[model samples]
Target: MHLYGCPMTRSTRVAWVLEEAGLDYHYTVIDLKSGEGFKPPFINLNPSGKVPALVDGDLILTESAAIGIYIADKVPAAGLIPAVGTSERALHDQWCFFASSELEQPLWLMAKHTFAFPPDQRCPAVLPSAEWEFKRQLKVLAQGLGDKTFILGEQFTVADVLLSHILTWATRGLKMDLGDEKLEAYRQRTQARPALAKAREREAHEAALKAQAQ
Candidate 1:
């Protein structure tokens, strides 16, 4: 398996899952900042010109959450996801959707308004409303999390990966306070996982190599 990613992007989530599952995969840094993502091969892999595209033999997967789910399913023994058709799996799906659609939306919007969009395209006026939306969604997340060690009880599933990743992006990348103890604790605990640490190190190493080659 091979992963095309940029350091500190959504690709980190998939890399974390692969590391957790102890999968052997090659990592390629797609220099999106240099317009490499929009060029030939990378553009062919993902027309959207985004990072975090996975190539496993004949199957090419895009979307970080989908790639994480595929990796988790490939290694069931890792217990990164619940059994299909089970209620636990349904809840896992719920959390994944919640993280991507609800929790992550505001953060992404904030990023766009802050720096992702060109100066003329950015709207600073929307930032306050986006922050409000993020806080509202965060309250919902806290309710859903309740008092579980992981999103699905004691088991650490891909759902936790998605949730924790988004939470980390919110707190660290966006510099927004979690505003709830449970959510903040959850972020710290999940991020401290050895697999995540290894994933971060791997991405950093690959990024450095890419920089030298350039």
Candidate 2:
């Protein structure tokens, strides 16, 4: 299997899931900044030219949330997601969609205005409202995580892997106040996982590779 993504992006979540699943796969970096992501067959792999596209034999997949769930199913022992056909599975699906649609959507908007587009093309004023939307949705997540180590109580499922990357990125981008204690603590706990640590190390190494080419 192979994963195509750059370092430290949301792709990190997919990498974390792959690591947690104990899967051996190759990581092919796509240098988005230099436009390598928009070139050649990478565009064929994903029309949006997004990172974290997974290739498993004949199977190819994209979307961070989709990749997270796929990895969970691939390695059931990891318990990254609840088994299908149960109440927990339904809740798992709910949280995954919430993270993507409710939480991540605003972050993407803010990201574009803050950094993605050229400075002249960007809307400086959008940051505040975008951040506001991000915070508003995060409040629901904070409430759900109250006194729990992860989204699904004690267990760290695919939901945590899916959303933690967003929460961590939001922390850096908005420098928004992390108001909820349990949610903040939960973020810290999951990030301290060996799989996450290893993912960071690997990502750092990948970054160095990209830098060396420059």
Candidate 3:
């Protein structure tokens, strides 16, 4: 298995999941900032020209959430997900969708307007609305979390991975107020995991290697 990624992006989610599953995989660095992702070689793998594309022998998967789920399901013994037909598994998929769509949407919108877009095309007006929407959505997530150690009650499944990672992104990238102490603590707890640390360390190491080569 191989995963292509750029540091400080959604690809970290995939890396984290792979690390948690204790899977051995190749990590390829794609310089998205340098327009490397738009080139034919990488584009051929994911026509969308996105980071966090996974290649597993004959199968190529794009999108960070899909890659994370695939990795988790592939390694069921790691217990990253609930039983196949259980209600917990349904909740797991639900939160993953919520994180990727409801939570991540505004964050990406804010990012696109703030820096992802070319200066002339950026809309400063979008930031306020995006931040507002993010806060509103964050409240729903906080209520969902309640007092559970993880999303589905106790086990640290990929649902927590998906949600926690996006919360981290919102906290660090958008500067939006998470508005709940428990949520913040939850983020801290998930990030403090050894697998997450390894993923981050690997990302930093690969990023540094790329920097030196440049």
Candidate 4:
């Protein structure tokens, strides 16, 4: 197994899952700043020109959420995901979709307008609306979480990984308010996992190695 990723991107979610599952996989740091994503080799892997693409034998998977789900399913003993056809699995899917579509959407918008877009195309006026939407979504997430330790209440599933990653991005990356104490504590708890730390360390180490080689 091999993963194409960049530091501080959604690829960390996949790396976290892989570490949690104790899976052996190779990591390749895509130099996004150098536009390697748009070039031939990496572009052939993911035409969308994104990081967090996984290649396992004949299977090539993109999308951080999908790749995380696939990795969890592959190692059932890790119990990172609930069994299919169960209510827990349904709810897991729900939070994953919510994270990607609802919660993460506003953050992505803010990112595009703030840095991803060229200066001439950026709209600073849109930032306020994006922040507003993010706070609104935080309320939904807080209510869904309630007093549960994890999303499914006890088990640490990939849904937690997905939601927590978004929460971390909001607070640490965007400096946006989580809007709820419960959400903040939840983010802290999830991010404190050893697997997540290892994943981050590995990415940083690989990135430094690439820099030295250049």
Candidate maximizing lDDT: 4
Candidate 3 achieves a global lDDT of 0.89
For residues 49-142, write the lDDT of model 3, one tens digit per residue: 8898999999999988888888899999999988789988888999999998898899899888988889999999988888888889888988
How many backbone clashes are present in model 2?
1
- Show how many residue pairs clash in every candidate, following the order shown: 0, 1, 0, 0
**By summed lDDT, which 10 consecutive residues of candidate 4 come out lowest?**
174-183
- lDDT string, candidate 1, 92-177, tens digits: 99989898999999999999999988899999999999999999999998998899899888999999999999999988888889
Tens-place lDDT per residue, model 4, 60-172, is 99999999999999999999999999989999999999999999999999999999989999999999999999899898998999999998899998999999999999889
Could you tell me how far off, in angstroms, the CA of residue 148 lies in candidate 4 after the best superposition? 0.3
Over the stretch 1-214, how does candidate 2's per-residue lDDT look in tens digits? 8888888788899889988988888887898988987888898888888898998888889888998899899889988888999999998999999999998988888888888888898998887888788888878998777777688887888899877887887786657666777667777788889999888788788778878987
| Regions of candidate 3 where Cα sits further than 4 Å from its true position | none
The superposed Cα distance between candidate 2 and the true structure at residue 107, in angstroms, equals 1.5
TM-scores across all candidates?
Answer: 0.98, 0.94, 0.96, 0.98
What candidate 1 gets wrong by more than 4 Å, as runs, is: none
Evaluate model 1: give its lDDT.
0.94
Task: Determine the C-alpha RMSD for candidate 1 after optimal superposition of all C-alphas.
Answer: 0.7
Q: Please report how far candidate 4 places residue 48 from its true position, in Å.
A: 1.5
Q: Residue 135 of model 3: what lDDT? A: 89
Query: What is the Å distance of residue 208 in model 4 from its true position?
Result: 1.3
lDDT for each of the candidates?
0.94, 0.85, 0.89, 0.95
lDDT minimum window of 10 residues, candidate 1: 167-176
Pairs of colliding residues, candidate 1? none
> What's model 3's lDDT at 113?
91
Candidates 1 and 4 compared by lDDT, better number = 4
